[model samples]
Target chain A: MPGPTALNFSEATSHDMFAQRLPQSKDDSLPQVLAAAVTHLHALIRELRPTQADWRKVIEFLTDVGHASDERRQEWVLLSDLLGASALVEEINSRRPKTATPNTVRGPFFRADVPQLPLGGNISLDGIGETLDVFGRVQDLDGDPIANAEIITWQANAQGFYENQQPDLQPEFNLRGCFRTDTDGRFHYRTIKPCGYGVPDDGPVGKLLRQAGYPLCRPAHLHFMIKAPEFETVTTHIYDGSDPHLAEDAIFAVKPELVRTFEQQGKGWLLKLTFIMVRARRGAGT
Target chain B: MPGPTALNFSEATSHDMFAQRLPQSKDDSLPQVLAAAVTHLHALIRELRPTQADWRKVIEFLTDVGHASDERRQEWVLLSDLLGASALVEEINSRRPKTATPNTVRGPFFRADVPQLPLGGNISLDGIGETLDVFGRVQDLDGDPIANAEIITWQANAQGFYENQQPDLQPEFNLRGCFRTDTDGRFHYRTIKPCGYGVPDDGPVGKLLRQAGYPLCRPAHLHFMIKAPEFETVTTHIYDGSDPHLAEDAIFAVKPELVRTFEQQGKGWLLKLTFIMVRARRGAGT
Candidate 1:
C-alpha cells in the first residue's frame, strides 16, 4: 500500500529536488541513494545513445511478453530468467551448500492448493504411460528424517502436455498430485515417464533467444516441490538421463547430480532417490 | 538492421510445436536458436510454477521500466542490471581482467554530440560552483600515451544539479564538455566541484531499491567515455571522495582505486588521476 503512495507522490512534487538537490536534514537517505543511480544513469545514456525508436521497440516487446501470457503459460518468468535477473537474485538471497541440491528458477506451472494425498499413494491419472514406481526418503540438513514432509509433483503427459494445456486430451490432475512422507521419511508414487518439452516461445523469450541463437528445449523431468515445517522448501526437477537434450537445456539447468539414470527392468523403470532438505534460518521476528 | 528479421517466424507459433523443436536441417540458425529457448522455457515454467498474477508482475515491471525512459533516462538498462542479466551476459562474453577496469551498467544520463574541445580545455561554464582543476593522462596498456584520444566529461554543480537538471540556475552544458588528448595523450579541464546527488526516486530503479532496503545515494563523480581511433572505447566514472554516502551508494559503484583525493590549496583543490586503458588488439573491430 505504501509503495504506490511513495512512488506516485514523488513525481508530482520535487521536480528539481531529486537527482539535483540534496535533502536538508539528516534524513536524506533516499535522495542520496537515488543520486548514484541517476549519475550512473546519466553516463550510461551517453554511451548507449538509444533513440526513441529503439525505446519503443523494447516497450512493444515487453508489452507482447505481457500479452503472451495465458491461463496455461507464463512468459514473464521465462523473460526474467533469460535476462539473468531471476537467477542472480536467487543466488544472492538463497545461499546454500553447492553439495546440497542447487535451486534454479521456480517456474510458472504450480498450483497453490494441490490436493494432499496419503503416503504410498499413486498419483498417476489412470496410470496410462510407462509404469514407473518412484520412492524417496526425506531428511533435514543434519541427515535427520523429516517426517510429515510434503512432496508435490506436476508434469506434462507422454506428448509433453500438462492437463491444463489440453483439458480434453488429458484427465484432470494427470501426472499431478501431492504425497506426504511417512514416519520413516520415505514416500512412494506410481506414475508414467515424463517426456522433455519446450517453453511457450510464441512470445518475447522466444524472440530474444531466437535472435541470440539459443535453444528452447528442456529434457524430460518430474517437477517436485518438497516442504516441511521449519525447513526450506526445495522446488526442484529430477531429469531423466536418457532425454536427448538433458545436457543442453536452454535454461542451463542440468546439474550432473540432479540427472538420475533409470534402469529398465520388467515392464517399466524403477525410480528411487533420496531427498534432503535444509532448515531455514528464521529472520528477526519470524 | 537485420535485428527484427533475425527472429525466426515459423517456430514463433504455438506451444506444442514450439517445445523441443530445435532447428535441424532446413530451419536456418534462427529457428534452431529460438526452438532451443522454447525447450528450456517449457522446463523453466514447469519448475518455477508461477501463478498468473506473478507472471503479470514481471511483464508489468519490464513494461514500466521501458515506459519510464526518456531523453535524460533509460530505465531499461538499469532494469537489466538490477536483474543481473547484463552482468552475467557480459561476464560470459567478455574476458575477465583482474587489473583492467571492470565494465558495468552504462546508466542513462549521458548526452550525444558533446563539443570536441582541444587539449587543456576549460569546461567549467561561467566559473560556476566550487573551482577545481581536473587533470588526467590516458595511456596504453604498456603505458604509452594514447595521443589524440577523445575524453568527454560532465558532472553536477555544487548544488548537485547538472546543467540539464536546472536550465535557470545553470548555463547550458554548465559542467559538461569534451576534450582531446595532445600528441602525448594527456588532457586537462577546469570545472566546479560536484557534490553527490540522487536519481529520480519516482523511477523504477528507485522504487525497487527502496523496496529492497538499498540506499539510493551515490558519491559524486565525473562521467567519462574515452575513445581512440584504434582502442576500445571505455565508458567509466571517476569518483570523488570526501562526499557523504560513499560506502553505501545504492548502485554498488564505489571503487576505492578510482577515487581521487583532492588537495586543498589557498582557494581551490587539485585532483589528479591516470586512466590506464587497454588498447584494442590490432584490427579488432568495434
Candidate 2:
C-alpha cells in the first residue's frame, strides 16, 4: 500500500505532531499524557473507519454526559463506571495483597462523620425493609485482628434509592452508620439488606443503557470504608452473592473475594465475613 | 494466572455482559453502534492500562469540552478536528473520482443562504487587505465545463477572524458571496486574501493546546461549496501553498490537491483553478 499520501495521511503525521507538542513541565505531565491519549484515540478512530455520522454521534453523546453531570449526579463518573474505566482504575490503583479485601467503588451515597454507634446498632431509620446484622472482623494480612479500626458503612435502601436520593421521603441517616472494631477486631451493625437496583438511569448514561438493552442495575451490596492507623484505608463493597446482577454489575466491580452469602435467620438475615487489611506503604498514610 | 481471580476478573467477563445488554431495536442501530464503540473503547483501555489518575484526567478533559461548547463555538468539533476525526470522516464520506476536487471540513463559519452575485463581482465589503480576483471553471470528469454551477464562497478577513466572529467590526457578508458560473463554466469574484491564524483558542481546547505545546494556527484558505443539478455538491478549501502552516493545519484538513498558488498581478493577486465535479449518484439528488 502507498504510505500515507496526503489523501490518506491525517493520522500518523498528526499523531507525531501532537505527541511532540506537549509542553515540558516539572509540576505535572498531565499535558503530555493527554496528548498521548489524543493520538491513541485518533488512531483508533482511523482503525474503526467511522463515518461522519458516527463521529458526530460520539461528540453528541459526550456533550450530553457533561450536561447531565452535577455535584450530586456526576454523570461523567457514571459514564466511566459504565465503560468499566472506573473498575479498571480501582484495580490499577489499589493492588492489594491476595489476602486483603478487594476494593470497589465508593458510590455517591457515602457520607463522612456519621454518628458512631456501638456494636449491633441499627442504622435503618426509615424501617423500609428486612433487617440484617452485618458483622465482620477487621484482620491483618496474617489473620491477626486489627483493633480500633473505624468502619464507615452505607448503602441504598431496599427500594433502590439512597436516603440522599429521596431526602423528603426518608428520615435522616437512613441506612448509614459508623462503628469501631473491638479489641477482638469484631464489628457489627444492623440495617436493611440493600436490594439490587438500577443506577441513576434517567440521565444520558441511562439513555445509553436503555438503548443498548442493558439493565441499569447494580447488584445488591454493602459499602464500607475501613481505616486504621497502620494500615491503608480501604473503600469497598461486599455484594450479596444471590443478587441477580452479581454476574453483570453495571460497573463491573464484582470480585470473588467480595461476594459473601447472606444466610436467613429467624426474623431477617446474617452476613459474616473477615476483612483483611494491608499495611500502608511507607509515607502513604500521610 | 488463575483465569481472572478477584484482582483480574472484571474486564473479560463484563465485556461480554455489556455487549449482550445492548437493546434490540429496529428504529436505529445506534445502540448496536454504541455497543461496538464501547467494546472497542474498553479493549483499548485495557491495552493502554491507564492509571486511575490518567482516566480521571480524560473524564475532566471531556467535561471541559462539553462545558465549553455553545451554538457560536463548537469546542468539541475543534477537539475532533484537532484529533483528526473530522479529516478521517471527510475522507470516508467524500470519496471522489481521481479528477474531482476533494472535500474538506465545512468549518463553523459557513453561513447558508449567502447573497448570490454576478460573475466578476466583489465579495469584500471591508476591503481590509490586498484584493485577489479568484476565477475558476467547474467541469465534469471528462474535462467538459459545467455551465451555471453555483459556487458558494466564504473566508476570514485580513485579520484572520471570520465575519461572524466580529460582527461589529466587519460588515455583514464582509467576505462571503455566492456566484454562478458564466458561459464556459467560468466564475470570478474579488475578495481580500485571508491571513492565517489560530482557531478560537480561549476555550478549553485552547488551554489544552497551550498545555500540549501545539500551535493553534491554521493555514490561510478560502472555503468553497459548489453544486449543480445532477452532480454531487463539493465542500472544499483552497489553501495558500505558501502559508507557513500548510504542513501543520490545526484541523488536519489540508490535502495536496487543494493547495493553490497566488500569482501577483498589477494591483492584486490572481488565483485561477479548475474544480472538477462528479455526477451525483442516482436518486441522491431527490
lDDT of each: 0.62, 0.79
Worst 10 residues of 1 chain A by lDDT: A1-10
Pairs in steric clash, model 2: A21-B212, A212-B22, A212-B23, A213-B23
Error of 1 at B2 (Å): 35
Give stretches of model 2 more than 4 Å off: A1-43, A107-125, A142-152, A163-190, A228-230, A263-270, A283-286, B1-40, B108-127, B143-152, B163-190, B227-229, B265-270, B283-286
Q: What would you estimate as the lDDT of candidate 1?
A: 0.62
Question: Model 2, range B1-286, lDDT digits (tens) per residue?
Answer: 1124323445565455566666667676666666666666676676667766567677787778777776556777777777666876786677788778988887767888689888888989877899998989999999899999999999998889988788789998889999999879999989988898888877887777766667678899999999899988888999997887776677778888888899989888999989999988897641
Worst 10 residues of 2 chain B by lDDT: B1-10
In DockQ terms, which candidate is top? 2
- Which model scores highest in lDDT? 2
Candidate 1 residue-wise lDDT, A154-198, digit = tens: 877777777776778877777888998888899888888888888
Candidate 1 lDDT, tens digit per residue, B1-286? 1122221222222223343334455545445433443444443444444343344464566556655665656666555444333433333333424555544334556677677776666777678667888888888777889888888787777877777657687777777788888888878888777888875567866686666444567578877878888777766677776776665444444455456777785688787868777767787643
Model 1 TM-score? 0.49
